[model samples]
Target chain A: MTGELAIKNLHVQIEGKEIIRGLDLYVKQGEIHAIMGPNGSGKSTLALTLMGHPKYQVTQGTISYKGQDLLALSPDERARAGLFLAFQYPFEVSGVPLSRFLLQAVKARAPETKAQSNGRPVRRPLGQFRKLLHEKMEILKVDKSFAGRYLNEGFSGGEKKRVEVLQMLVLQPEIAILDETDSGLDIDSVKIVAQGVNSLRGPEFGALVITHYQRILNYLKPDFVHVMVKGRLVKSGGSELAEELEERGYDWILQEVGAASTESAEEKGADPDERS
Target chain B: MSDHEEHLGERKSQGVAIAEKPQREGFERDYNKYDFRDPEQYAFKAEKGISRELVEKISAMKGEPRWMLEKRLEGLEIFLSKPTPTWGGDLSELNYDEMCYYIKPTGEESRSWDEVPDKIKETFDKLGIPEAERKFLAGAGAQYESEAVYHNLKEEWAKQGVIFMDSDSGLQQYPEVFQKYWGTVIPAADNKFAALNTAFWSGGSFVYIPEGVEVNIPLQAYFRINAENMGQFERTLIIADKGSKVHYLEGCTAPTYSSRSLHSGVIELIVNEGAQMRYTTIQNWSTNMYNLVTQRALVYQDASMEWVDANLGSHLTMKYPSVYLLGKGARGEILSVAYAGAGQHQDTGGKAIHAAPYTTSRITSKSISKDGGRASYRGLVKVVQGATGVKSNVMCDALLLDERSRSDTYPYIEVDEDSATIGHEATVGKVGEDQIFYLMSRGLSESEALSMIVLGFMEPFTRELPMEYAIEFNRLIQLEMSGSVG
Candidate 1:
């Protein structure tokens, strides 16, 4: 398997407050990687920083996508570069319809063709694209009337999350990062949204599913699970580590890391040559 | 000491670039000292203030009907008793007695442009009035002072039961219908300026479209104030009968005068059921003039009313065109753009009152200010108690070109019904220097980039104008930005 998304020594901050300190992670193609952490453990910060959000300041880091630097691009450029972030809260741009926005986004991502029809240049028509979109919406069980309405204006919580999944399915990016797509969904909606995400799993795509509970992990089985604590990753393991954390919680990991640091400090005085 | 009174042609003949010409310090008097010399010209015009005597005299001079004179007298009393409005733009400097209420060129109305006097024709030629009318307009009414001397419309439009003529001629020809709907949509006492217009209004457009007729071409009226200290009050009335449509455009300009002149006009539109009416104006009055106008419309069932207004010049302006939705399924739209420069204050917006069910309205306003000027948006959206299922949206965006400029949004939204939905959005920001620098880096001059950006900001408004008016609007904005640089 090859690495679809990679981050090395990622250091992120928000207004001089360091959030993600010296973090490294990777997810391969056709695999799901779940990151679990406590409340202030930089889970959402990492997700947004990877998507190139303007508010997240990356003080020191290098994010590479297929052997190319990802930090040197705008948000829209990043999205066009096959990176998608299912925002925990999507922005509502009133008066701009969803269908119109998608059309513009599709055109922005396509290269200009040199062929002309009659005296005008011809591209893929929007009508055909809309038909394909309607089929995707049917699979996701979304209301057909939402196409004409403003994007994210007056949408319910569950409906907004479903729309995010639908956007991921339509854009079909190389990498998808879900901040918290299941935070506000009901039992049935959780299943339907999970099905929508699983439909996008293939050899051409990879997904980073950020979650806080093992309930969603019952549906999405990640190949690797990483534990993040206090802005740094302390442990990495296979699928069993998720079950251990779910059963015993993070108390043991915190106690073990604290004792290890104190023991190393005392041993430094006894063996100065070994420390140097 | 503004130079709004400088004649570009005169300065150009003297081998001077008018944009870079120097001005005398502390100049306070009007530069036009030469009075009318024609032997047939009157020594003095009518009185400066409003009176029944002055109204009656104007009607008699036009050979108007008895009913028309009676309406003028009624409007005269309304003008006399009404007080100046204390709202909107500044009005502390307007003096009624200091203005010359009327001025007529020393000739009868001429149908041919070549027959007009050279001095009067020179001004029209400099303004490019005749060429634009001949090439692009369906009809053109060129008013030199207080009276229109040339009025003509295409024969094809006249054959389709579309009547386009001066208001004075409309009164003589269609007396019964003209008297019925005149001042009905917007009454004489609607505002002080409207009352003043009714009392002393001289030259304006009067258009009537018969049922099932649609004139695709736009009719235009060009008003030029040549005389010094003259007040030009033009009254316009448009009535679109069932299933008819028309687009009317009007433009104005004046030479710079030291002493301020006054412009008060009234516009009343009656859009019948299943009809559409569009009214556009690009008023570039000299910076020494005060432009105060009252315009309104009454839209019937399934009818539509659109007002595209652009005010680029004037020291002080207080004008808000309104629409009253009187029947179900009626629609109203207003796209207005205003620019205020030094010593200018533009207080302009729109009002939409929904009185019937299923009514809809949209208002988009864009304003730009620079050189310590102020631009204010004062709008209103009112939905009555029984007007259910009404939808309204208002967006106002103002751009300040410098730190000294100011922009304000004072919107009044009153919804008495539960089923009505309304949304209002406003944004105020200064020009980003990075945007200017980026455009300048591409080999374009700074002024050209600024002009292009300003035009793009007003694209939503200018795209609604007719071809000729849109071209003229671009030219006017280019002229206004000649030397406006930081």
Candidate 2:
């Protein structure tokens, strides 16, 4: 696939329990792709597996980002390669200031700031970095005073999601994967967070947003929405599928797929009898 | 042995009161006399060494006030009575008296930098003490051996009723206040090493911040041990009065020697109501040194105390900076970074006692060990029965560079009240191969990648340090990484 993110036949497992089975996905540049599913449907599983999270064992699949094998890279390497994952449950890294953490993340992506420790590099002083971080934070509705706080520590649920969005905007990752960004946000908070995500859409950046509800989809309006059930994407459609799923619910699709499987099984049994 | 005991008295107590007392006698005495005429000779050293009589003589020679003397005597008794602790790093190789107890420089104290002896001044110059003071520090004091020889303060600070001087000089000048508050936070009997320090306290800084005054710039003390077998005991005491604020920075270095030098000192801080105090230390003791120091502070209502410690050197070091939340709304924090290389063991941590309601504390400790070095974090977070609504968080991270290195954490949490919130997290691991490969693929050498990973591991602590110290600390990490990767 000629796109920012392309995963073909992606099969992933944890402790031999296959969580994402033959998952195929592609997100083009400047497009917002949403993966909607119920709990235990491997939505988060696929998100983590795509980002090179160590626990997810990827098998029989090729995850390519802009024609490079993304599966072969470490999490940080993938992050450096412009693949960012806003974890549904962000890891609390104490003693690391959010500003400093973002600075390192930015410097990792930008080559000019990387200097040997022994050499004196005349880089931007901390004040400028602080100001830039504050500007980004203000854009994301984050308090400026949070620059000094430990990353994700003592953050309210909405605050945590906002911090994730703030990092996504500041780091400017090309393929940002947000897993359940609207899980804990209030209605207004969800809208604000969606607005922040919406602001990052561009030809240079593509996003894969994972959600379990259609409420956020109303605000985001992903160009393509895929339905995932039982570790695989059962159907693919446009943004209308999200509205359809919200209206018809997951049971209708599950029944249709389940009945089709039973009918195929009965036909196969009858063919065997006629052959005998 | 009897004759040796008799000869100990003739030694004049080495006048320095080294780390270990009686058994470290003649070796310390001869070394303190500037015996290295060639300036290029080296001496043999030991790893673990301390003793009791060394404590007694250290107390006796200082001519300490009667109460302090008695406290030291009590400390000596405790040192003899208590068993060596077994919970932290291994202490089996330590030999009491094998270490020089007292090894002060042989010279008269000089108030002016120009008046300091040429040799000592050269050492200080090499360490960049004078230049650092001139460039950034508001005040500077240089201590060699067991006493501060040259001290200076900005005229503005002096005029603002601030007092900064050597601890001994402070006692002599302000005897009443000194006596009233000395050992109030950390009594001699608090620990064996503290007792040892109390017995032979020497060249530490004494700072008094007047009420409602705030010192804009940081005052610094640079301690350098230029002599072989020298024992430097510097005592420091800081008092921040009501609504006052102060920042004190201290750094230490010792010349490369084969024989071991011992450093034991005490630091006591008193933060009055609404006051804030920050103490920062960056120590680079050579591998032939044993550094054991004690530091504690009492935080009054709405006061705060901070300890920013970086331990980059020393063969074996045991130091824990602690804070006591003695008043409501008081706060305390400790940010420490330690690096232990081959033949070094860094056992350092912090303690926080929430004795008042609504008090808070936080401790962030980071350590890295390489090539047979051992780094350990041992800490305590305690909340008394009446200290309701207290909160504390402690995070310890130790990075082992190779298979030969070791890291351990022993944290004690005691919450005597139901309303307290406490959290602790620790991690011990080696540098992941993938992290190294990723950095190497980006064109960094293996050593560079390793250094970057190590720096990243210590980023939590370094990011909190001041700019100059952060730069210096990164350089020290690079130096420690030398010969580590290749």
Candidate 3:
């Protein structure tokens, strides 16, 4: 209940259809949690809802970040409050250079760069900011030409995923939810992106990574691995739980839960609505 | 439930913050601080409404020759005979009787900056015309209300035999050269607005680049309308002779007013054989102004013409710049951008005509509409018979910022030659919530995110502008986008 990112009994609906049902989660300070699920299992849904995407409607329950009611803030306010979400399929925003976008974003997120007297917003010294940007980009191995090209306007899938991680390293949010950040990346790119995210790990940072494949877990070390199925978390344990699912698949857990429900129903000898 | 509605105030403040002119990168200055006002005084003024007597009086005031006087009367007859255009934005709100035909702020154009009127000089100074002209322009003219208040040309260009002056003086000093190509590209009877401009034209730039002499630096002009219910009908004529090249930039801005103003002008460009000319216009009229302008170019053999136009402010604007490729191997291109904010309508486009063999043309238009605004692109591409090997392509892209806005594209193509290749592409899209969320996740407020997206959408046109004009363009757009998202 007092974690960096905590969600309790959350229900989400998109365009009148429920996508996430009774989902509860907790990510503590400096802890990395991985949510692994099959396709359409609402892993991406949970991340988007946390980021306050207007299309994903939160129907019930609560999401609190660092003991604050996160839903009360707009998406930008949430960002300024130190929360970030790396999109699964990044949107291409043409005409905006990556360098300019990053500069403005850094200014907006940092407290010192807020609007000052006479309503004029202040910015950091250009030379200092540019030097820092070049250094971070070099760490991510992004080409200098990428600075001038429109943000993800014509990026390949692997390039898009890497750029998302680069943004995380630049913004350095307190709680980062990376939705399939390693989805389409090649082996080398996957290692590079994971390294960028790994460098940000500290007492000031917490992250919830959502993915369908366990291959990324080899590079990104998760303290806890959770299995999500049909909009609910079916199981949770240490890192070995991911190895079990990767080998045996999800049918064993579904079988156990299905049989358990049927046996309990027979013993009760009552209507289904009352059995709960 | 979340306190969803309680954040409107925050959104509004955030929107307003984006509008406050940010210091340009490394410039450490804001131009919005320089906006000032002056009393609407005049040395001479023409009466309201268009009449034959008023046209004759205007010609007499300038001491025009008999042929020019006769031409003015003929233009008056055409304007009286034609009716107001019924299509393309609302024109019923324009009142001819309530409009003042002309208001001359100064008696004569100042040869030196100090000789200019104090009030008029301050206005242009605030607009940053003098500073920008000093750095890069070959010549510059500033028009206030109805007259050219100040004009100056660099001595180098004067020595190179380039004629840069107000249209009135171009008529008086170089009568033969001015009278030959004037109105030939945009004839008086071409359209109602053209006829109206010819009838009551007053102050605009006239440039004559001699044969084989290229004017490397840009020749620029600035136009401002200061009074309410006033009319500005300026006529611009540019002639680039054989093997000569020139680029002319014109910028317009006006103060906000309670009532409506009308701006109807005619621009004629004659590109002689082997010559090239580009005309760039940045029109930031106040929201109360109704702008209807006719601009056209005639290109001779192996000549080329380009129009780079940006229309960012107006209540209702109807303008479509056109080029006529009259000679073989002539080329034409038009890149236009329009932004329509609250209570504004921008109806603009480009037209290309292939009248000779082996002619090629291209038209690219980008438009954005927000806060109940409407932006439309209406274009035409025609290849006349026997004009073989003609190639034309038209691309139009529109972005609507919010649900209240609207955008549309209407393109007409006529190909008479069998060998011609013509293609057209248009897209109309609203700002996707996904894109907005992406930028917002980066900590940009909703309005700032939207404005950045809009600027990115207009990068093609803005990149073509010079540094000073581009900065001014971005500043105007930021102001227009303020408080637009709530």
Scored by DockQ, the top model is: 3
For A29-96, candidate 2 gives per-residue lDDT tens digits of: 78889998655667877877776656678878899887889888766667777778887767555555
* Candidate 2 segments exceeding 4 Å error: A1-3, A115-118, A122-139, A259-276, B1-92, B95-154, B157-202, B206-218, B223-231, B235-248, B252-259, B266-288, B294-313, B320-486
Clash pairs for candidate 1: B4-B256, B5-B256
The clash tally of candidate 3 reads: 0
Query: What are the RMSD figures for all models against the true structure?
Result: 13.2, 11.3, 10.3
**Model 2 residue B257 lDDT?**
26
> Candidate 1 local accuracy as lDDT?
0.70
On lDDT, the candidate that comes out on top is 3
| lDDT tens digits by residue: candidate 1, A1-276 | 354678999998876777788999887678788888665667777887887756678999789887768898655566666777776666554434566556545554553632556644467787887996787788789988887766677999888888888777777777888877887788778778778888888887788887767766677777778887756788888778888899988778878676223234433343211221
Score each candidate by Cα lDDT: 0.70, 0.70, 0.76
True contacts kept of 2: 0.04
After aligning candidate 2 to the native by TM-score, how far in Å is the CA of B462 from where it should be? 8.3
Per-residue alpha-carbon lDDT of candidate 3 for residues B266-378, written as tens digits (9 for 90 to 100)? 88899999999999988866566788888889999999999999887667778888989999999999999998766677889988989999999999999998766778787
Question: Residue-wise lDDT of candidate 1 within B1-486, one digit each (tens)?
Answer: 001111212333354211211111201111222112223244337766656677788888889888778777877787778666545565666787777676554433213444333443443343455554421111112343323332334567667888877787788899898888988877776666776777777777788999989987676564322221123777788999999988887764322222336888888899999999999987766566688888888999999999999887666777777889999999999888888777667878888989999999999999998766678787888899999999999999998988876777667788999999999999986656544432332222456546655765676777787665665666556545655211
Best by TM-score: 3
- Chain A TM-score for candidate 2 is 0.89
Would you give me the overall lDDT of model 2? 0.70
Model 3 ranges off by over 4 Å: A1-3, A115-120, A256-276, B1-40, B107-153, B223-231, B252-260, B484-486
> What lDDT does candidate 2 reach at residue A81?
73
Task: Evaluate residue B281 in candidate 2 and report its C-alpha lDDT on the 0 to 100 scale.
Answer: 85
